[model samples]
Target: MNILLWHVHGSWTTAFVQGPHTYLVPVTPDRGPDGRGRAETFTWPSSVREVTPAELAAAPVDLVVLQRPHEERLAAEWLGGRRPGRDVPAVYLEHNTPRGDVPDSRHPAADRPDLTLVHVTHFNRLFWDNGSTRTAVIEHGVVDPGHLYTGRLPRAAVVVNEPVRRRRYVGTDLLPGLSEAVPLDVFGMRTEGLAEELGLPADRCRSADLPQRQLHAAMAERRLYLHPVRWTSLGLSLLEAMHLGMPVVVLATTEAVEAVPAGTGVLSTRPEELARAARRYLADPEAAARDGARARQAALERYGLKRFLDDWERLITEVRS
Candidate 1:
């Protein structure tokens, strides 16, 4: 199948294009958001091809995979007015928790009979009112970075983009108190200057923006992973951390409670409690390694690359048929 999708979420797309089907990604001169085309930081399979809007009009697309709301219109306009879910089969992959009104949030595809709505987490499936739109939950699948954890650094690793702007939503506010117990090293886009912004010493908390390969290596050295995101469908970074054989300390909110099972690490609603858990892991290398082993096992069982690709393939066949 020739699947059409944008390069919106890098980690998810990295896992997605590894499937059997040929992927058609849109590219522009500037490589703008709607048309970033191929990935640069993360490696992708050869099956993923980059094409311009003009080329897409003549291309044979089996199905269009919609991520952002504007993609619905953009796909149709670029594909010679072949409207998605009408001329071409389409599915809206919702990668976020509803933004407004909490549980009362209505999905953009709500009541749209033509397009099927797919969510990355079950938590998003329950919260977003899909109404008449067909819905499915495929969870998350990540390319395992293997069990590279050393736990040599007595600190916590966090991955969040633009943490200063997203702030509370991505759990930047919780880091200060948590850092008092265990130092934090944050990784992602625009993560530099986080320590200065938070008024913390360079040792207590520091940030760096590294490529996926380097980021994974850096994270593996940390004692534990910290997921402070207050609301999100699910973060690929948390799963990636587990795949790296690092124990985790996550806030028991949204889909995190389901992702981080007991014994894998600690899940708490309180910041102080999370701090204590981080301290325990930082002090005991053996205990951290034990929990990290369990974390790697659980991640393999649930979010392995093979399983994730298989699920997507099945959905593609169904949608195409």
Candidate 2:
């Protein structure tokens, strides 16, 4: 089967490409680090021709897998007329929270009668009405060894794209309180408002997007990781942190409640409780280490790349059936 995967999640491309069938990834015009545009146009597995009304019209695409409405307009272009392998299925992977009062069944992608929706977390699955949508839950998975060597560290960290809405989801405001008791680092796309408003010391806030090695290195720098999400669904970042042997101090909302077990970290409703748990991890490093070890064990057992691939294959085959 030739699948046209958008390859938006750069880190997961390896696993998807190595699966049972060939994957046709869309080429980007920007020839950056990720396999974007180049004159020659490299192809492996299979390269679905660059997305255009006419070019995509000719490609023998079996399925179009998307994570969101990012490519809705471009994808809609090739909706008409079929050649041979033309009337392919479309799959949308829901990777985050539902928008507004609208349910997943109302997703723009689901407007296509041939489209199937896949959710990455059960927390997200519940948000869908599923009246007009074929919904399936395929939780995020990670690739890990049987047991990982966890290093001891002093502080705790949380990863997020926007750091300013500190009080909102990702608990940006919690960081200042967290850093007061225990040192914390925020990694990923940073916002100036968060940086200016929160005024966490230079050591506390940053706008750094590190490589995989550096990301793991950042995780290894702390004994525990704080999730503290208030709005969004379970973030892939939390699972990555768990895989890195970091026990989390997260809010008991969304999938974090299910993702992090009692043995893994502390979950609570209020920010004060979260702050207390942060202190517990900070004061009792030994306990945090043990929790992290358990978290790593849980993460490896539940979320693995091979598992995700198998789940995806089953969904695709089920749609075929």
Candidate 3:
């Protein structure tokens, strides 16, 4: 079957592509917001092509998976009219919180009969309704486990895709004080100017994407992973952190509250409370290791690629039917 997984967003489509059928991903020239085009270098087994409303409407695409609602509105006009399979069986995936530009209708992409609304986390599924029929809940997953495993490192780490200078909704802002209590390491593309605000010179923090192998090593070396996501859906980085046996410290917001069990880690929005929790783990390294072990066990049990693939296969099969 020819499955067209169209999402301006990247990095989250690995599971669907690992299936038994052919997979097609659209390529974008630039990776920025304007770079709506898919990447030509994508080496997924099935195929790659440029996606536009015209091609989407014309192709006998079996299943069209959307990562955002805006994609549906763009393709719908070209779909001629939405239908179950002929034009495409479309599924809209809500990957993050709806921002200021969009309203809070949970099923913002459900306007089309052919479109199935899917939420990345059950906690996020609450903000929408479908004639009392709730949207499907599929948690986002981490693809590479090799990067996360048992290791003995003393630092607390937060691996945001971008650098942290000032405290943002994510862990960057508060991490300094947390790090002051215990050493902290922040990694990703540099935040550039925020170092002054953060008061940590850029050099003190690693501000670049580590190569895959190095990244895993870095994750394992850390005993703690700070995930202070004030806004947005559950972060996959948290799951990756769990997989690596890094006991986590996350704010009890959105899905973070559910992802971290008491044994796995602590979830509190209060800085002092979080600081206390950090102190507990820092003071008792063995307890931190125990929590890290539990976290790894939990992640391997629930968020493995096989489990994610199985759930996605069921949905794709439903679309095909």
Candidate 4:
């Protein structure tokens, strides 16, 4: 099938285009948010092609996979007034936890009968009030970076884009205290000045935005992966970290509880408890290795690439039919 989706979330899209289908990504001159084209940092298959909006207007689009709210309108404009779900079969893939109202937030696509709402996590599906919009849960899948864990660095590995801007939302504020307990190597975009901003020594709170493969390798070297996001649909990095054979120290929030099963790693609501867990893992490489093995196994069983692709295939077929 020919799928039309934006290059919105790089990691998620990287896993997505690996499926057995031709993916049409929109490209603009600037390659801005609206039309960022195909991924450059992460290796995507040849099946994923970038086409201009003018080309997309006449291109064969079997199914439109909408990630952001504006994509619906953009799709119509680009398709020469052919709206998604109405003129083309489309599904809005909600990758975020609602922002404005805690649990009372209504999804923008709520009560819309035209398209289906596909959520990456059950927690997102549960929290979002879809009203009459048909909804389905298709959990995240990542292209396995393999079990590259060494755990030589006794520091905690963290992956979050724009930590300073997102701050508490992505658990950037929790890093200072966690760093005091165990050294943190925070990674992702705009992470360069994080150490100075957080008022920590460069070694205690190191930050860098590396390419995907480099990021995975760097993350594998750390003693454990730290996922302190207060609210999110589900972070694919957490799954990728587990796939790298890294024990996780995740905050029990959003879809993390469902993602991180017992024996995989430590899950806590309290920061102090998580900090203590991080310290324990740093102290005991044996325990960390043992739990990391369990984490890799669990991640493989649930979030494998094959399963992810198969689930998407099933949904695309259903949506198209």
Candidate 5:
């Protein structure tokens, strides 16, 4: 299948293009948000090809995978005014949870019966009002980072992009308290001033914007992975960390409750409880490693790339047919 999709989320796309299909990604001169072309940080297979606006306009697209709401209009313009889902097969992949009016939050494509709304988590599917639009929950799948856990460093590791800006939503507010239990090594974009903003010393809450490989390597050295996000469809970073064989301490919100099962690590709604769990993991390397192994196994069984790609293949075939 010739799948037309934008490079919206890098990590998710990295695993997606590994499937048995020709992925057509958009490329602009600037390679901006709508047209990131190919991923630089993560490796992709030859099946993923970059198509310019003019090229896409003429190319035959088997299925259109829409991530952002604006992509519907963008796809029409790029496809020479072909209406997605109506003129061509299309699916709207909702990555984030609804923002306003929890119960009444209607999806933008809710009224479109021709399009299928794909939610990354069951929580998102339950929360979103799809109206007459068809919906499916595919969950999340990640390319395994391998069993890289060393737990050599006695600190905790966190991967939250723009932690300072997202604040409590990304669980940045819980970091300071967790830092009291175990020092945190933060990694992601726009996290440079996080230490100062959180009123913590530089050593306690150090931040770096390492590439994906380096980030995984650095995170593996830590005693445990910290996922404090209060609300999200599901975080790919959390799954990636588990695949890296790092024991996690996550806030039991959104889809995290399903991702981080009991005995894999600690899952708590209380910040203090999660902090205490982090401290325990930091203190006991053997315990951390035991849980980390469970985490790796669970991640592979639930979020493996093969299953993800298979699900997508079936969905695309059904939609296209």
Candidate 6:
């Protein structure tokens, strides 16, 4: 299938284009959001081709994969003003959990029978009111970073982009309290000033924005992975950490409770409880290794690249048919 999609979410797109299909990614001259084309940081196969707006208008697209609400309109404009899902088969992939009003969060594609809405998590599907539109939950699948856990650093590793801006939503506030029991090494974009903002010394809570490969290696060195995020969809970083064979300490919220199993690591609402668990993992390398093994196994079973590609293939066939 020839899939038309935008380069919206990097990690998710990285795993997606790996599937067996000719992915037509929109590319602008400036490589802006509307047309970022192919990813530079992550490697992509030749099957993933870049198409300009003018070129996309002429290309034969088997299916349109819409990530954002604006994409439907953009597709229409680019595809000779043809309505998506009506004139052309289309599927709306809902990446994030609904924001703003909780109970009354109406999906932008709600009640639209023209397009099938695909949610990334079951939690997202349940929370979102899709009206009469067809919906399906296809949980995340990650490209395996291999089992790289060393747990030699004796510190908790965290991955959250723009922690200062997102703050409580990303659970940046919880880090300070958790770091009291275990040191934290934060990795993500715009995380440079996190230590100063949290009033922690550089060593206690340091932050860096490394490339994905380097970030994975750095995270594996830490004693455990810390997922302080209280809300939002299941983070790909959590899955990446598990794939790297790092034991995790995650808040029991969103899809995390489903992802992290018992003996894999600790899952609790209380930051102190998670802190104590982090301390335990820091002290016991053997225990951390044992849990990390389980984490890796579970992640592979649930989020392996092959499984993800297969699921997408099936979905694309259905949508195209």
Q: List model 5 lDDT by residue over 1-321, tens digit each.
A: 789999999998898888888999999999999888999988899999999999988899889999988999999999998889989899999999988999689999897879999999999989988899889989788988899999999999999999988997899988888899999999998899999999999889999999887889999999999999997778899999999999999999999999898889999999999989998997889999999999999999999999998998889888988
Q: In model 2, what are the clashing residue pairs, if there are any?
A: 142-303, 142-304, 164-194, 166-172, 166-173, 167-173
Considering only N, C-alpha and C atoms within 3 Å, which residue pairs clash in candidate 3?
26-38, 27-37, 27-38, 27-39, 28-37, 28-38, 28-39, 106-128, 153-221, 167-173
Per-residue lDDT for 139 in model 3? Answer: 72
List candidate 1 stretches off by more than 4 Å: none
Q: What digit string (tens of lDDT, one per residue) describes model 1 on residues 212-231? A: 87999999999999999998
Candidate lDDT (C-alpha), each: 0.92, 0.66, 0.66, 0.92, 0.91, 0.91
Question: Model 2 Cα displacement at 287 (Å)?
Answer: 1.5
Candidate 4: pairs in clash: none
RMSD of each: 0.8, 4.4, 3.7, 0.9, 0.9, 0.9
Q: TM-score for candidate 1, please give it.
A: 0.99
Clashes of 6: 0
True-vs-predicted CA distance for residue 81, candidate 1, Å: 1.3
Write the residue-wise lDDT of candidate 6 on 208-304 in tens digits.
Answer: 9998768889999998999999888999999999999999999999999999988899999988899989989988999999999999999999989
After superposing candidate 2 on the true structure, give the runs of residues whose Cα lies further than 4 Å from its correct spot. 11-15, 31-55, 70-73, 76-86, 102-105, 109-113, 145-151, 165-167, 191-194
lDDT of 4: 0.92
Instruction: Enumerate residue pairs that collide in model 5.
Output: none
Q: How far is candidate 1 from the true structure (C-alpha RMSD, Å)?
A: 0.8
lDDT of 4 by residue, 14-121 (tens): 999888889999999999998889888999989999999999889988899998888898999999888899889999999999988867899999998889899999
Error of 4 at 284 (Å): 1.0
In candidate 3, which residue ranges exceed 4 Å CA deviation? 28-59, 73-86, 100-107, 129-134, 147-151, 163-167, 201-206, 211-213
Q: What's the lDDT for residue 217 in model 2?
A: 70
Q: How many collisions per candidate?
A: 0, 6, 10, 0, 0, 0
